[model samples]
Target: MPLLPGAEPYHRRGGPVGVLLCHGFTGAPQALRPWAEHLADAGLTVSVPLLPGHGTRWQDLRVTRWEDWYAELSRELLLLTEECERVFVAGLSMGGGLALRLAAEHGDRIAGVVVVNPSVRSDNPASVLLPVLRHLIPSRPGVVGDIARPDAVEIGYDRYPLNAAWSLARLWREIQRALPRVDQPLLLLRSPRDHVVSPANSALVLARISSIDVTERLCERSFHVATLDHDAELIFEETLEFVRRLAPDAKADDHQG
Candidate 1:
């Protein structure tokens, strides 16, 4: 399948600390590209893989399951582990759920985790009908481009594939059950004005995770897609700081201007 313009995966080799960023469901790597570039410029190796069924048409996504997306991220993490001394995983929305799952399953292999406006559960009353709805309908209106900045755009499908969404719901339940196993340092950044995901998602994860070293910050000026919103620079700087604290040997100072 031909990838959408700007949806290409990104990989840059740099220092001993590697960061893997995962874009949200229906979203391509483009959504997180700037953030990856920021980290790469800071001298950290970074990888942003286009999840399976993404970066293409929504019809393609309907045929894919959540496991496919998780598998792609897991593969990228393994590659990073082979090349770097320390690795951190971060994601936006559903990708955040995947990051948490990685921390739970991989344990000490992941140095830390960062999530932006993660989606662990749906507040929509209609979600209960997904199993049946997915069989009857192919898609629903998309939940993309929820940025506070009017000019910022998120590259993703215009509709939500019902089948894929059901799979995501299952993934969330699995992550919730395994939250107790996530002991790595966690940085949870969220937007209070997010229109897509509910704030309770972050609260549930925070209350369940076993990590002792955890920090929560509010993106007061942004929306769901905070990476491309007003506090984008804040997310980039804070992430670098968090990684630096955890991996002191990381080459964060080498690329300073």
Candidate 2:
């Protein structure tokens, strides 16, 4: 995994209900910044950690794998768990996958989860052929949001990284295995125009989670990375509502007895 970005201000907020934001593969924390700010404004601490080999050259991604990504996210999540009484996990693309893993492995510890176009499956016809085709494909790099990257890089790479996809495939399998163990409230967001993972992946999450406290929404404006797209605001608003409904201050009977 590549080095993580500075999570300083986020660490400084200090609170009970913290929100951890994970960026996607070849993507940086820029995509999650808006969401983080919104949550922070609501008095909830937010942390948007850059995944390994991301927010840098695409070549760095070649040496990283899914496990590396999970380790880093887990570290950040554990830290939040220590400082905050309750925590929620949110991520875009591959970061979304990591968030799912975090919730699955630490279900009892997390308050809830928000997944935006999580990339558990590539759905690319190429990866299924030889299984290793993902590891063999070369990808340039990609980012989310038409809203301009913080680092000022284009969104989505032209080239496809075969090895990276292979790692993602493995990661997806792990999430699948971990699904049965997860029972937290979830907000799943998907874009109809997304070219990455198939919608079926979202269905898998809805069906496998041991609990039914899950809600899935389709982003009308976004493509793959709903973070920076047209529906980003809606994603943020709905996510906030979900979080509020689950907050400690919220009445348990607000939605039901």
lDDT of each: 0.92, 0.72
Can you give the lDDT of residue 14 in candidate 1?
A: 89
Alpha carbon deviation, residue 130, candidate 1 (Å): 1.1
> Which residue segments of model 2 deviate by more than 4 Å?
1-14, 129-160, 249-257
The local lDDT score (0 to 100) that residue 20 gets in candidate 2 is: 88
Which digits, one per residue and each the tens of the lDDT, describe model 2 over residues 162-242? 577667778888988888877898999998877765787787778788867888898966677677777778888888798
> On a 0 to 100 scale, what is the lDDT of residue 1 in model 1?
84
Question: For residues 117-231, could you state the per-residue lDDT of candidate 1 as single tens digits?
Answer: 9888888888889999999998998988899898999999999889998999899889999899999999999999999999999999999999999999999999999999999
Question: Model 1: how far is 153 from its true place, Å?
Answer: 0.8
Model 1 pairs whose backbones collide = none
Of candidate 1, the 10-residue stretch with the lowest lDDT total is 248-257
